[model samples]
Target chain A: MKILVCISNVPDTTTKIVIGADDKNINTAGIQWIINPWDELALTRALELKDAGKISEVVVANVGTAITEATLRKSLATGADRAIRVNTEPADAWTVASNLSEVVKNEPFDIILCGIESSDHNGSSVGGLLAGMLDLNFISSVSGLDIENEKLTVQREIDGEKEILETQGPVLLVIQKGIAIVPRIPSMRGIMQARTKPLQIVEATSSESMTETVQVTLPPEKGKCKMIDAENAGEVIRLLREEAKVL
Target chain B: MNILIYTETREGSFKKQGFELISYAKALSGMTGGEVISLAIGEIFDEELKKAADYGASRIIALEADQLPDNRNLSKLLIQWIKQANAQVILFADNNTGKAIAPFVAAGLKAGIATGITGLPEKTDPFIVTRKIYSGKALAKIQVKSHYKILLLAANTFGIKNDPVVPVIERHNIEAEYFESPNKIISTEKQTGKILLGEAEIVVSAGRGMKSPDNWGSIEELAQILGAATACSRPVSDEGWRPHGEHVGQTGKVINPNIYFAFGISGAIQHVAGISGSKVIVAVNKDHEAPIFNVADYGIVGDVNQVLPKMIEAARKIKTE
Candidate 1:
């Protein structure tokens, strides 16, 4: 079986988030980028499948500008067999789905995996959108997965319940948090071999799919934390009802 | 022109988020001077559709067919209904199904959409909407700059407000077409827990400091006493100490509640993003300077093992008193 993992390059969680001067876009200046934390799960799980001898190769794919290649290379270090860059500045979910659909038109795999959502956008749309575009079976916000023979069973995290689903191969999944295993770091030899692996870059075609960054602005800083005095939990509840009206 | 809100369903009844979507749509309709039309697809519910009136949905468009189960086909049906209704704005709850179909519906309609929106659009001239970005560390104001707009609301962003003038629920027909391949649901496994996060008023979360899964019982006890839900840091979930659904972080569920208590959690931005919506945050970690305390309302620097049992005992005593 062959596996495909979609990867994203995003600002590290520790970075102080800043919008551009226009107030509608992320300020990329002076920020260190890393592989999106969730996508690491996708990559690591793929590697685990390979280690278990369930799959042959794991290819990491990205939809973004040239700068994202560095993150793709990092994915290779983590354990991907090769990398594919759908050379497009991923504007929105639809655009990324279109670019991925184009890349997938040529390369077929038994399973496709992606983080539940992009760290930056936190949309959680890609896996299902890509599945829709590819017309394949899909599950969102999955917490566990087990594959056997030609079928796959997954545990999904819904609003308040856990759902176990069974489906055939060639399925797509949006890997959610708390599920699966933590991503593994690449060994020294693995990193060295990654340099020799093939990296393909292709430009995206224009279509109805389009996304534009208008402006980005930070939310107002939270007000000072209000300390509810001891023996006044009722006071806290009253304040919530009267002042904040949050209750 | 009208506004279309997708009232998502499971089994048969309308989910709470569906009402949330209608509430938002009602607000948007009021702002846009448009009528609010809600669409309920699947084993259809007239009672659920009538409830939309309480939130100001003037019309309910429903498509009852097997295709409603397939999100791909659902998207197509939604697009058709949107075109038929001549909708200007579309609202959806940012749940799994909504997240899956909102972008596709927007794409099919040739419109621009904004997800993770916390509130109604501040300004419609340029379609500027506020969204929680960087895990609630900051907020970004986005402008769609499109004629037709789409918005997917984040959970717990708006509280349910019952309108005095309930909407008159009207039903309309939605034609559903079948797809070549349909995804089937074999079964569902519900997470065994005291309360669901979305419904919980308070949450007590544990981290690696709990030491092992065996130690989770104390946290569960505290949650039970408080009538709250139990959550964990990403590590605990990764280590199989807790179910993934209970993981709260950048990669986990984004939760907003009245109070949040952290036990042995060192605040990481990923974790912070998921729980930042809590009104009152209290952190109990040995590290005095753990980031969790940065935003916490009260900080107690101590070992979780020592602090947890005492806290649970104290809570129980308070309840008895």
Candidate 2:
């Protein structure tokens, strides 16, 4: 079995996000980037399957500009057999999925995995759009997965319930954090090996973006917190109802 | 112009977010001078259908089915209805199910799609909307230049107001073909007799400061008294002290409750991102300098072990009064 894991390069979660001077994008100065946390989890799972011999190879794919190659190299170092970088600045989820669909049509893989949503945009649309474009069965919010003899079983969350689902081969999954909670770190040996591995660059075929970013702004600053004495705990409830009017 | 809203149902009743979507659609229709039409599929109740009318649906379309199919199947069914109604704009709740299917439907219609939207369109001429990006750390105003548009409204961003109006009900007996999906539901497990965390107005959450899972009893009791949902920080869930469903953070479920009470939790940037959209935030932590205090509307510098019991007692007393 061959697996394709879609990866995204996003700003570190702890980075202080500052809107650019133009107010159309984020400030890039002195900002650290990392593999999208959820996608890291998905990649870790794919590597585990490869280690178990369930998968013959793991191919990591990303849709972004040239700068994203650094992140793809990190994924390769983390254990992907090879990496494919679709050269494009992802304007929207539709554009990203369209480019990915072009790659999926060329690469034959038994399973396609992606983070349920990118931590940056949180659009949660690409995986579904890709599945739609390719006419493949898709599952979202997957928490558990198992494969046996080309058959797959998945556990997905719905509202307040967990649904255990069974499927056949060649499936797409928008995975949440369950298969592997902790992400894998690149070993020294793996880093050396990744430099010799294939880092293929494909020009984006889809040029149309359905949505355009008009501006970016921070949320309005909340008012100062009213500090209450711990001794008078009852006042907290009163304030919540009267002053805050939320209770 | 005709606007279509997908009103999703669990079991036979509409979810609370469904009404919120209807309320939002009504406002959008008012702006565009369009008609609001609701489409529901599966085993639906008349009372639920009436609720949609009460909210502001001008017309309701129902498709009866024995089971709710997967997202791919549902999207196929929706495309047929969308074409039949000739809807210009489509809306869905930004929940698990909506996130799964809305994109598929949008792709099929060749429509521009936006999810996690925080506000109404600033301009509808070219159709521009605002949504949170970088997890609530920043908001982006997006313009969709397409013939058709799809949007998923973020939870708690819009208030649901009842504009009670009778709606015309139309039953469509259409034979929809379902794809041969590799996915099959084998079993389901539900958290019985508890308000769903996603829809709760008030949420009480805890972190590692609570010490152990044994200490969660007081948190649950307080949540019960206030008719609120119980949530946890990522560390608490990672430690297996709480179910993953109750986890609220950047990597977990993004919540937008009216009031979010953080007990014994240091505010990490990831956790703050999830609750930034909340209306009122209250933090109770022993460390007064905790980062959570930066975004909180109310702060109590005390230990959770001591403060929680007192707060719970005060809440119980107020309820009895």
Best by TM-score: 2
Q: Which candidate's lDDT is highest?
A: 2
Tens digits of lDDT, candidate 1, B75-189: 7778778888888888888766677777667656656777788788887766678777676767766667556677888766776766634555555544433543434567755
lDDT of 1 by residue, A122-200 (tens): 7666776677678676767676777787567777777657777777778888886645465688889988988988889
How far off is residue A98 in model 2, in Å?
0.7
lDDT of 2 by residue, B1-321 (tens): 688999887778887888889899998988887789999887788877788988899889988876777788889889888888888899999888888998889889888899989788997997999998877989999998888899999887898989877789987654645634557789988767788887889999999999989999999999999999999999998878888888898888888999999999999999999999899998999998999999999999998888898899888988898
Chain B TM-score in candidate 1, rounded to 2 decimals? 0.87
RMSD, every candidate, angstroms = 3.8, 1.3
Where is model 1 more than 4 Å wrong at Cα? A19-24, A51-53, A146-149, A207-211, A226-247, B10-12, B42-48, B61-68, B146-148, B164-184, B191-194, B209-218, B221-227, B286-288, B299-321
Give all TM-scores, in the order shown. Answer: 0.86, 0.98
Every prediction: chain A TM-score? 0.91, 0.97
- What candidate 2 gets wrong by more than 4 Å, as runs, is B173-176
Across all models, the iRMS values in order are 4.1, 1.2
